[model samples]
Target: MRILVVEDQDSIRRMIEALVQARGYEVTAVSSGAKALDVILTAPHDLVLLDLMLPGQYDGFEVCRRLRADPSTRAIPVFIISAMDDPESRRKATEAGANAFYTKPFSPIALLKEIERLTTGKG
Candidate 1:
């Protein structure tokens, strides 16, 4: 499966990339929401791991909204991995069309499990 990971932090991005790659999935990692939108719009991915606080005008919320708004990409699963842990952030993510939300300091194993479940329909 193909997965797109959008994160602004270099270390975090690389870590997630390595973790996902170890799972045998193709990964495309980017540092900005704009780049993420560009990559995702041009190619197909099985899942997207997005960070809410992005470095561009289009944040993760906007990206998810756009993806949901576009007919061609509406069904793509979006899992938000962000530092925002408040209810408001979670609610906004849900309203913006995220399939799941994981806060910072999340369990890597659990994240991988969710990724597998979302992509392959198995836990």
Candidate 2:
């Protein structure tokens, strides 16, 4: 399966990439929301691991909204991995069409389990 990881932090991005790659899935990572959008629009992916506070014009919320709005990409699963842990952020993420949300300092095991569940229909 293919997974797109969108994170602005260089270290965090690399860590996520490594984690997902170790799971035997293809990973395409980007440092900005704009780049994420461009990549997603150009190609297909099984899942998207998005960070809410992103650089450039499109934040993670907008990215999710756009993906949901587009017929071609509407079915793609979006899992938010962000530092925003407040109820408002969670609500906004849900409203924006995220399938799941994991706050920062999240359990890697749990995240991996969710990814497995989303991509292969197995938890």
Candidate 3:
């Protein structure tokens, strides 16, 4: 499956890309929410791993909102992968239409399993 990873941290972004790629999935990584939007709008992605903190005008919440608002990309499954591990952040993520929520320093195995579940409909 094709996936888009929207993360600001260079190391985290690279790690996520590597992990997903190793799982035999195609991945597109971007450092900002705006760039992510552009990529998603132009290309089809099966899933999105979005970070709550982003540089530029829009935060991850806004990014998720925009994705959900667009018909072409609204149905895509999105998992919030961020360091914002507060209740409010989780609420906002859900309100923004995220399929799942994960905090930073996340378990790689759980993440891989979640992605597999979301992509293949098998948990």
Best by TM-score: 3
RMSD of each: 0.8, 0.8, 0.6
Off by over 4 Å in 3: none
lDDT of 3 by residue, 1-111 (tens): 899999999999999999999999999999999999999989899999999899999899999999999999999999999888999999999999999999989999999
Error of 1 at 85 (Å): 0.3
Off by over 4 Å in 1: none
Highest lDDT: which candidate?
A: 3
Comparing 1 and 3 on lDDT, the stronger one: 3
Q: What is the C-alpha lDDT of each candidate?
A: 0.94, 0.94, 0.94
Give the C-alpha miss distance for residue 53 in model 2, angstroms: 0.1
lDDT (10s digit) by residue, model 2, range 7-101: 99999999999998998999999998889889999999989999999988999999999999999889999999999999999999999999999
Whose TM-score is higher: candidate 1's or candidate 3's? 3
TM-score of each: 0.97, 0.97, 0.98
